[model samples]
Target: MKSLKFLIILPALFLSNLFAQATILNTIAADPESGIYLTAADYKNNQLHLAGNLSTNNKLRLNDFLGSRTLTISHKGQNHEFSKDSIYGYRDKAGNDYRLYKSYSTPYKILENGKIVIYEIKQPGHKQNGFKPLVCYYFSEGADGEIYLLSLDNLKKSFKDQPAFDSIDANFQTDYDLIKYDNYHHMFRINRVLAKL
Candidate 1:
């Protein structure tokens, strides 16, 4: 697996516009209103898991909306309405809440102290062409409950120049090529990208 060369995640703003609400990341590092919060815990099975929660009990999950379907061409022999596949929201106020759960594929990586490992990229397509992820598990009093795993974009922004680079742990066996045998056309291959800090 290729190691992550850059740190900060880039242009990681896909859902910022959906919010009339405010994020407190500007004020509190662990603010409920801020951005995604990352929390870590060691499981009795000897594995680490990071959990993140949305800021509100009413929230959205982003991963369920990615990818597109092949639309039939118009009778004019031309394709029509080629656009990003979208995840629909409800007509209720809760539908207005920004989704905190987005999907990303990264190599299994352990945190600085070697007590936690965040697993991602379980499929192929979820792994991007360039960039690595810096993930954290967040647990807060909101509907945004989720696991922390920043994209290559955000990883690039936060750790652009910080000297304290976390070392990637090289344990655990990941399928690595699970997508190849998936037998599904739209199957997303999530590659493992690991970063330590």
Candidate 2:
């Protein structure tokens, strides 16, 4: 009678464990809609296991605020605190992804993702009337690479080892045109140059 009871309980325990594992894996997509990424790998893999919704109300908004050393995230029915210095970045509720590149705590909106990732960030301009904020562009060789200014001269100087970039200027009229996204190809023009390299 004891042996039969143990056999019956073993299968139930196995099935329970399997279900729990499946839930954990699926939680990335089953969330409250926004999350903090612990690493670049986590962001690249779309793994949002720490699933939570962040409040960016008032002056704490990312676009307006520079950034603080710590970030508090509400997750799993509790408030969890994470250091911006320790984590990669997060995705906003609107589905825009931001990257906390290196020591620059201010998040840079990731505009394009590929072998080379392009980022855009706005800097406050003159507070005078009719002055629009300056829009800046940045790029990184990869998810783990250091971010660099997105300009033809900058790209040429940074990738001195890559000879293929020498012909980059021949393809575009100006640096601005070089950075433009090619809607048909669904990638940045600079990305197309790097792809051939």
Highest lDDT scorer: 2
Model 1, residue 113: distance off in Å is 8.6
| Local distance difference test, candidate 1 | 0.26
In TM-score terms, candidate 2 sits at 0.70
Question: Per-residue lDDT tens digits of candidate 2, residues 1-197?
Answer: 99999999999999999999999877655544577678889888987646645342211133325556776665555666667778888876656778886664678999988767899998778868357888888888787688988887877777667775676656756768757887889998778777876
Report the error of model 1 at residue 108, Å.
Answer: 9.6
What is the lDDT for 100 in model 2? 81
Error of 1 at 163 (Å): 1.0
TM-score of each: 0.18, 0.70
Candidate 2 clashes: the total is 0
Pairs with steric clashes in candidate 2? none
| Global lDDT scores for all candidate models | 0.26, 0.74
